[model samples]
Target: MTNMSAAAAGPNATYNFKVVLLGEGCVGKTSLLLRYIEDKFNDKHLTTLQATFLNKKININGKRINLAIWDTAGQEKFHALGPIYYRNSNGAILVYDITDEDSFGKVKNWVKELRKMLGSEIVLIIAGNKIDLEHERTVPLEEAESYANMVGAKHFYTSAKLNQGVEELFLELTQEMVERFEQNSQTDLNRTQRVLVVDDEAPVQSSCCTGSKTN
Candidate 1:
């Protein structure tokens, strides 16, 4: 994470993170991305072909962060290409339609694939989309929450059509990514400092013997 002061030095230092949206077709993955990026939604179904990319810039605690979001194609044919788009993603949004139980099951499969390829380090959020249709929902919120906890991911209900819980979801994920990056950076810095101290002490120990020999 870039320091808030870094933004004052010149232009706001921008931190870029790649985030991918994954789920089955018609699960509102595209709608969620569209609502977040463009603040608009359509009733007609728009199936993603290969993948769609969108960039959103936000400020987190005075630091600039850019989320490069990828809305992936969820059809079976495009399944193999999912790993390609999310190869080095910093985070992921695993979406599912709350009204469709099958979609929720597919979310699990997507989570498994992500874990297998990216490991547990990638920040994950399980989005139960279509919350507007809660009256017809087949998957219970508790079930989704339990699965999210089991997989070490956060879960939230979202309704892109109504623009509810969309912004907060992305903001929370971005914050998590920033925190993770900062923690990893601090760990690396501590390790480097320890190595430098060891290297400096070696020369001091070696020079002490040389001074004794001269005496």
Candidate 2:
């Protein structure tokens, strides 16, 4: 177990993490990213460039993770740039507009492309946005959740406009990433203490000698 008192007394260090946002055009990918980055909502329908990059820092489990958030352009024309952003990303957030049925329909394609481009080790999350406009919602939560489950991704319904579940989703992802890091760290730590026997005796004893053993 990590010592809570030591963590509180130690100097905080920033651990770099990469995260990307993906979805079809007009799926509120930019909106959610902007809301998370700037804490301001803009309903403007501006097209994102090849990519939108943002830097953010989050504290998870008493450790700081400096996130390099890549918000990819959702236009079909910019599809060529998708691989560049997805490559080496620690996690991905796949957004779909709840009100736009077409956008919702493209979720599977986006997830497939992410798996193809980023590999299966990356953390994947499906975000259903525009939930504030319930009357305009075309994608049901159950269906979205079902698809997310099929892809083995976390599912979340968020309304960037209403500021609902946006922070919680980021926090959840941060915790997930941190938990994964901690698990890997522990695995590495466990691997470091290999038992080896060293004998200063003759060549005959060297062969039979057992190295240092762990406590």
Candidate 3:
């Protein structure tokens, strides 16, 4: 969906966008973010603090968009930390393990919490992960899709093990963020230029005073 590569944003320009990943424990949230950011997935089930950070870059519409992904712990113990990660996020991926009925059941709770803390402007994506283990699948595709539709989120089924649809799901979210940034950047550009002009003029005026005295 990103028409332009990140390289096109030039060597000096950097766009930082923030996104958060949420779901019940062992739903592959860390695996999905790791796979997307480093192209590697680990079997390790390390406990993340209230939140963990990951970074990645991609080209969209010929511009570089840098993603700051916050992977939060899904355990109930980390519930108080939810708002800490949700605030100021541009997008979110509500992940669930396809083989875990308990994880799937928590999707609505995650969404509701996010809405209460993060609000409606943030983009949301519903991700059903662990699709490679077809035999262990417990959540039906149609049901997940229906839930996503109800919440107006783009839905995806992925396998962190096989690396299926993991990148695709992230690309969709990045595309949405890039589109929003582009729309808002016109005003941002003008504001930046105005600040630049003011800074330069102040120095120029001081230099003119010294030059006039010398003459």
Candidates 2 and 3 compared: the better one by lDDT is: 3
- In candidate 2, the residue pairs with backbone N, CA or C atoms under 3 Å apart (3 or more residues apart, or in different chains) clash, namely 196-211, 196-212, 197-210, 197-211
Write model 1 residue lDDT over 1-215, tens digit each, in one string. 22211222345577788999999999999999999999999999999999989999889887798888999999989998987898888899999999889989999998998888878778999999998998999998899999999999999899999999999999999988877776666777799999998987744444344445552
Note the Cα lDDT for every prediction shown. Answer: 0.87, 0.78, 0.81
The alpha-carbon lDDT assigned to residue 105 of candidate 2 equals 75
The parts of candidate 1 lying over 4 Å away from their true place are 1-12, 201-215
Clashes of each: 0, 4, 4
Tens-place lDDT digits, model 2, residues 33-59: 888888988878857888978999777
Worst 10 residues of 2 by lDDT: 1-10
lDDT of 3 at 62: 59
| Top-TM-score candidate index | 1
Q: What TM-score should be assigned to candidate 2?
A: 0.80
Q: After superposition, how far is residue 109 of candidate 3 from its true place, in Å?
A: 1.0
Off by over 4 Å in 3: 1-13, 183-215
